[model samples]
Structures are given as structure tokens and as C-alpha cells.
Target: MKAEKDKIVSLHYTLTDDGGVTLDSSRGREPLSYLHGHGNIIRGLEAALEGNEAGFSSSVQVVPADGYGEYNPQAVFEVPREQFPPNETIQVGMQVQGESPDGVLNFTVLAVNEKGVVLDANHPMAGKNLNFEVEVLEVRDATAQELSHGHVHPHGHDH
Candidate 1:
């Protein structure tokens, strides 16, 4: 059946950044399944899936405004390294939750120094265009429980 509101749609997708680096993919594995028009995927991709059918393959580019969002310089800051537990092996690429001017936020450790640490709060993919290659694998009516739960229910699921 054609994908539409409340339908359960399964698709294999490869999500990449503007740099053409693979960010995520559904291959050699189960196709991602979710209730159509249920905010189960990125807005741009979800909109593109509307009215599509099984075996439909296409590519879509999602802008920061629609994907994650632009990077805010104000979100990155250097803070006293002492705040983190000593001997914790502070290292680049590690993630640490910290309190920011706005609220608690997740920050990726960009650098570490005796004076402080560099934290970037922007999403790893923020400020970039996201490219998505999608192939619809299946589309069928969603079970009542799937609609109620706002997700796809496995075959013969209790719900």
C-alpha cells in the first residue's frame, strides 16, 4: 500500500553529512520501521516518504534548519578542567554532560588542557546539510497499538 498517515513504513536509508561521510545507515540489518506521519524520522525525510511505495528509492538533502540546526558559537566554551573528576582521563572525543548558560547540555570534549576543557554543545552534524538515500521496503496499515504508541510494532506483537 502507498505510504500515508498512520501506515507502518519500513525503509533502508543511508544518512550522510555534506562532506559525504556516512552518519547512519540501515543495511545488512533490519530496515527502520516507523509509523508514517508520526514524527518518527527527520521532518524532511518523512515528508519525502509520503505517498511513496515499496521499492521506491530516492535521495534527499536536509538542511540544518530541518535536520539538526545551525551551530551556535555561544554554545561552545572552555571551562575549568578541575570541575571534572580528577584522574578521569579527560580526552578529546569524549562526551561529558555539563551545565551551560541555558541549561544542562551534552558537550563533546574537543580539547583538554591544564587550565580547562573545550566543550562543543552543537550536535555533531549541526550547521551542515544532511543527505539521505532512502528505499522503501514495505508499507502497510499500522496496527491500532502502533498508532497509539507512536511507533512500529513488531509482527504479531501483543500490542
Candidate 2:
């Protein structure tokens, strides 16, 4: 089978940045599986995998716009220290979640001080080009449940 819409594609991938630093990998772990053409992975990688069959291997470069998206300066701001839980220690690089008009927003603490904490809402990888070394391990028709859920469901699992 080939990777296409509604199909389940399993692959082992090593993701790196333009600097060639590995950001993630599936080696030594169970192959990652996702429903193809369902926004389950980065757009560029997904597009590149289209029509590929099991055992296909390739290196794909994805721009920031197609990967995590360009960094937004407006996403960085300072919030008063009191906004965080009183018992929690605010530290740089800590991930924090808060309610926003659109929904819950996750931000990374860039700095901490007496008055406020600086947080950046951009994804950690935002603005960086992503390079992926991928090997497709399996391709098969997605189960009806998996299609309905918009994700892959492993055997004997409810979610």
C-alpha cells in the first residue's frame, strides 16, 4: 500500500535543524504512525510522503513556514509574576499554559524576575528549517475508527 489520504503510514524518522543538530528521532523506539493527509504531521513532510510506499527512504528539507511556522515577535510578552501559581517556581525555559481568547496557549519562560516573567509563545522550533531523514516502515489502510478519530489507533487500544 501507498501513503495517501486516510491511510495509516508508519515510519522511522530523524529530524534535524539546519545546524544538523538532531531534534527528534524514532530510532530505538517503535516506529511512529499517523494517518496520512490528515494534518497528523508537518505539512512539508506529509506532502513529501504522499504516494510513497513502504520502504521508501528520503531526506526532505522543510522551510519554517511549512514546518513550525516563522517566529512571531508579538508572541513574546511579559506577564506579572502573580499570574503563576504561588507555589510554583518560575524558571527560564519552563513551559507554562494559560487561557487565551482562542484557547489554551502554551508558552516558554524566557526570563524571570521580580516584576514579571518574559514568555515566548512561538513553538520552540519556530523559524528554523527542518531536515528529515525518513524511512517508511509500513503503509496500510486505516481502520474506520482511526479515520473517524483523525489519528492512528494501535491494535487493541481504545484511543
Query: In candidate 2, residue 20 scores what lDDT?
Result: 90
Q: Which ten residues in a row have the lowest lDDT in candidate 2?
A: 150-159
The C-alpha TM-scores of every prediction are: 0.86, 0.96
Give the per-residue lDDT digits (tens) of candidate 2, residues 1-159.
889999999999999888899999999999999999999899999999999999899999999999999999999999999998888898999999999799999899999999999999999999999999999999999888898888998673785
TM-score of 2: 0.96
Predictions in order: lDDT:
0.87, 0.93
Query: Distance (Å) between predicted and true CA of 130, model 1?
Result: 1.1
Model 1 lDDT on a 0 to 1 scale: 0.87
Backbone atom clashes (below 3 Å) for every candidate: 0, 0
Error of model 2, residue 43, in angstroms: 0.5
